[model samples]
Target: MFKQMVIILMTSVLVNNYVLNKFLGICPFLGVSKKLKQAAGMSVAVIFVQVMATAATWPIYTFLLVPNNLKYLETIVFILVIAALVQFVEMALKKFIPSLYKSLGVYLPLITTNCAVLGVCLNNISDGYGFAESLVSALGCGLGFMLAMVLFAGVRGRMESSDVPKAFRGLPITLIAASIVSLSFYGFRGIIDNLFK
Candidate 1:
């Protein structure tokens, strides 16, 4: 069971990364990845949102939706849970972590609508993960997202300092870099399969 949990965690973080592999949170992954500090802040916020969403939704779906046979309402239910969690997080950050709150600024609010958060919550139900499994999976996915954001921020920072063609500057260059990073994750395709086999 421990080994399987590790595999699930690794698969979520690497093989099926929400950002690079699944392509779900590209907006913040690009918008907030310009600076390392900002990327780090967003990473923490995203991870918090992911973990909390999973923790909250897993029980709700398992106890409420599944038993009630209201599975069809999952999308709506999950979104409401996520929105509430994000709002709670925003308030906590503003009151407790004011510096991070300022650093996160607008991106913090964006978490309310972040499909990545919703996607993970919904995926946990569809995958039939238990509470513990869902928590670990969400943690892995969030960390994977953070990893991508930090890496891209570093790359973009260097690109800013280095010479580049007029055609490859700005968003064009960032897109190219994103493509390369996405391609890199492809190397993990067979890893999870092999682990299980």
Candidate 2:
């Protein structure tokens, strides 16, 4: 069981990253990643939301939805849970850390619709993970998202200083950088299995 949990955690963090590898949440990946501070703030918010969403959704699926023949409503339930969690985070940030709340701006609310958070909850159910495993998976995916955002922010920072051709100046160069970052995550594909071997 321990080994399985470790494998799940590592696989989600590196091999099956929601952002870079799976392409689940690309909007904030590009929008907030312009500055390191914004990226870090958004990443932390996302991590909090993912873990909290999984915590809320897993038991609801297992105890409520599964037994009541309401399995078809998992998508709706999960979204509501995620949106609520995002709102909670937004309020907390606004009250406690107004600077970060303002820095996040519209992207903070965007977490409500972040497919990465939704995907984690849905994938946890589909993968038949136990409660603990689901939480670990969400945490791993959250860290993976943070990693991608920070790295891309660094890349974008460099791009800001570099001299680029007029053709690939803005969105074009950004997409190219994002693609390269996504490809880099493929390097971890077989690593988890090898580590446990």
Candidate 3:
């Protein structure tokens, strides 16, 4: 079980990263990543939502949905769960960390519909992970998101000061940088399999 959990974690964080690899949650990835502080804040919020959503959804799917033949409702149910979690995060951030709350702007609320958060919950169910495994996977994905955001934030910082061709400035350069980052994650494709063996 421990080995399995570690593999799931490393795979999620490095191998199948939802941002750099799988391309989930691109909105916040691009929007919040302009500043390291905002990027970190958004990442933390996402991590919290992912873990909590998994905690809530796993039991609902395992104990309630499956047994009752309500599996078809998984999407709707999962969306509701994610939306609620995002709302909670938004309220907490507003009351406690207003700066980040302001910085995140619509992106924070957008987490409600963030495919990455929904993806983790649905993937947990689809992958047949147990409750603990699902939690670990969520945490791994969240950390992977943080890794990507933080790294990209630094890249964007460097780009800001560098002279660039007119055609490759602004969003063009941003997308190009993001593509490079995504390509870099491909290097980890088989690391987990190799390490476990």
Candidate 4:
């Protein structure tokens, strides 16, 4: 049980990273990652929503969806849960953490539809993770998303200060950078296997 928990935690963060490996949440990766501050804000928001969504959805799936054989309804139910969670988090942040809400702004709402968030829940179900394991995996995956976003934002910030050709000025260069980062993450696969062994 402990070993399975560890595996889920490690894999979600490194081996099966949401951004680099699964290619989820690339929209925000390119859209809101221009500045470190914005990247950090989005990361925090994602962490909050992902963790809560996982916690909430796992039970719903286990007790409600699976028992009824309504697995086909997974996408709809998961999405509804994520949307409501994001709204709740946004309101709470605005009330208690005004600065954070300002930092996150429109991006917070955008995250409601983020495929990565939905993808995490679905992945957890597909992997047959129990409640505790799913929660850990979701947390790790959220952190991993934050890590990738911050790293990419830093790289992008540097790119803004550097000289580059006109044609490859924006997304082209960013794609190249992401490709390199993805390749680097591939190295973690072997490390994950070794850790599990």
Score each candidate by Cα lDDT.
0.87, 0.89, 0.90, 0.88
Better of 1 and 3 by lDDT: 3
Which candidate leads in lDDT? 3
**Candidate 2 lDDT, 85-143, residue by residue in tens:** 77887888889988977866556677887899999999999998889999999999999
Candidates 3 and 4 compared: the better one by lDDT is 3
Candidate 1, position 112, lDDT:
80
> Worst ten-residue run, lDDT, model 2?
100-109
The segments of candidate 1 whose C-alpha lies over 4 angstroms from its true place after superposition are 96-106, 193-197
Candidate 3, residue 146: the lDDT equals 95
CA lDDT for candidate 2: 0.89
Ranking by lDDT: 3, 2, 4, 1
Work out the TM-score per prediction: 0.91, 0.91, 0.90, 0.92
- Tell me the deviation in Å of residue 154 in model 2: 0.9
TM-score of 2: 0.91
Residues 19-99, candidate 3, lDDT per residue (tens digit)?
988889898898889999889888987887889999999999999999999999999999998788778878888899889
The whole-model C-alpha lDDT of candidate 3 against the native structure comes to 0.90
Model 1's C-alpha root-mean-square deviation from the true structure amounts to 1.9
Rank list by TM-score: 4, 2, 1, 3
